[model samples]
Target: MWSGELLDLDAYLARIGYDGPVGEDGELRPDLGTLYAVHRAHTGAIAFENLDVLLGRPVELGVKALEDKLVHGRRGGYCYEQNSLLAAALERIGFEVSGRGARNRTRGDTLLAVTHAVLVVTVDGEPWLCDAGFGHQGPREPVPLARPGAEVVQGEWTYAVREEEEGILALSILREGIWRDLYAFSPQRYHPVDYVLLNHYSSTHPRSVFVARVIVQHPGDSVHHPVRRALVGRELNRLHADGRVERRSVEPDELLALLDREFGLRLSGRDAEELVRINRAGD
Candidate 1:
């Protein structure tokens, strides 16, 4: 159950740089074409980031907070925040949408917890997988859910969905000439409270990776995307989309400037200083 009236659809579309056709009544066009356009625009405009977690700032999953931070503040967020915002916008636009949780299997063989969030949207009676949260490796468009082994290609990227078990689906991406499992999930629908718990564990748990370092990611320009990971006051690793990565030592003095310039983060002097201090302490 979503409070659709609370979401400003126009603001969300504007924030994502989507200028697609809104109906005469000022509602978003509820069709597959519009969904693809919106998904691409969202992935391109908004970024996948976790700066707040690293800075010890509370990551609120509520709709109003998401609108303020991601839309008005011109900031980026991780999976929960990103997908949650997208889901709300879709619901407001009259699309049938539901939240699904998945285990992030990109790292290794071990089955991780259900820490990722994705959206399953039905357009014209067919279900499509729409995810705007997964940084560079994310799909730029919706993938058909009916086809068991369908490959969806967007620009230079290629993704696939395969049936892993009776009701489980495995999403994989082509990386280095290999198909890698990105995540796996069932058809079980999740609620806002479920994501709240996941977000809490991710943002606050000691073993959670979000607290260990600063990870800022944005869809790249043309042929090159960038993922900036910093150990604050130590080293900053910039991974490019062209497979060329550059690593450089970072001093505390230059952290603020780096975040502002490279990650497009708008931070006050006090906020910057506090983030730098936190990163140095490795808390």
Candidate 2:
């Protein structure tokens, strides 16, 4: 149960800039069109960031907490927060949404823990991968589960999910004429409590990448021209839809400005100062 009833649907819709036709009861239809619209609108509006981890704060997965920080507070969050809010909104709108934990394969070939959170939505009796949390290189719209291994093009990007060894499905992006694996997952469904454990390790573990880096990503938009800008630690990379990657290093003085100007993340004065200090330490 995603506790979708507890979510303020109006505020959530407004936050993502998705204005759907509402009925007399203010309900949007549960269909593929709504799913695609919400998925695109959410990713385009909210950024993906780990400022709380960098600020030495805990990441809460509760729907209310997510609404407070992400929806009301106008801040961005990493996977758990992103998809949890998405799940709540979709469930509230009457879509059958389930959680799936995926092993992030972008890092390397060695088998890593299933730390990434993705969603499987059932629409018209078919499963579709709806993920709003995989950062800049993630899909802009839902990928059909029924059409696995078939190329689905969204704007300038192309994605396909291939059947991997042992019932695993790997989502890949076509980059520079190569189908590079982004992540893979099994059929096991995860509960809200499951994410609590994963969130703990991600935000607290000393060796966890989020605990070690200041990561913020913007997967661009219509007005922004579909250019993905990802700032990991000190490196700022701009990935174009045409596969052009513009890289640069972020100076301590340039940190806050870059976060606001590039990723649309505006931290408070205190958070900004602390982030600058951390950047200066180069940790």
Candidate 3:
């Protein structure tokens, strides 16, 4: 639960580009329509990025820190930061929210550790999974927490929630004609301290992919838009809604401008130059 003063609703709503109706008491009333609107607005406004981790900066999880870095600073963050912020806002808006830990099985067969975070929101006695941290692979809207084989189609993506075991749910997406598992999570609730441990390991560990390369993502222009842009390492990729992908390597000199123009990130010229140099040297 969050207090009104701790989480500024006006600032948050503005940051996410949400202008939906609110109660006369100046509080958001939780409902399916508002939840969907807020979820869509957030995913479209804020990006899923790890540039701070690559820059060797500490990732903070506190609400104020998240507000400063993400909302006010006009920057994007990874799962922990993004989901934590969303959970706080949702809670402040009179929704029942809980944090859950998940394992990323998208890249390999072996079950990975609990390194991902998601939100379980209850409305009208039913649960829904809301994730705004997954860059290009996440759903555009919340999906009802249902049994295996239950599918939710959003634009070009079709997602399913599978019951891997008793209390564990696996979220999979249809990609290239294959149903690929994105991540798996249980019903147990997580806390900010749990995210602290996960964030430290993800930001500092040498083997962590976030620290190894530069990754940035922002949603497409509209729900009907077919393309989303992402910068992975030295390549910029445009992912089409119909499974068509266009990619090109980014030159070192053009990295800063691209980040600012395409990703809506503003960084000091010195910092930008250093990032480009480090990224190129790593390649």
Q: Candidate 2 lDDT, tens digit per residue, 153-231?
A: 8888889999877889999999989999999999899888899999999999998889877889877774336588899
Better of 1 and 3 by TM-score: 3
Q: Please list the residue runs of candidate 1 whose C-alpha ends up more than 4 Å from where it truly belongs after superposition.
A: 24-26, 221-251
Candidate 1 lDDT score at position 214: 73
Give lDDT for model 1: 0.79
Q: lDDT tens digits, residues 85-136, model 1?
A: 9888888878898889998998887868888999899998999998888766
Name the candidate that leads on TM-score. Answer: 2
Model 3 lDDT per residue over 213-251, tens place = 889987664555667888988999998767788999998
Task: Decide which is better by lDDT, 1 or 3.
Answer: 3
Clashing pairs in 1: none
TM-score of 1: 0.89
The best candidate by lDDT is 2
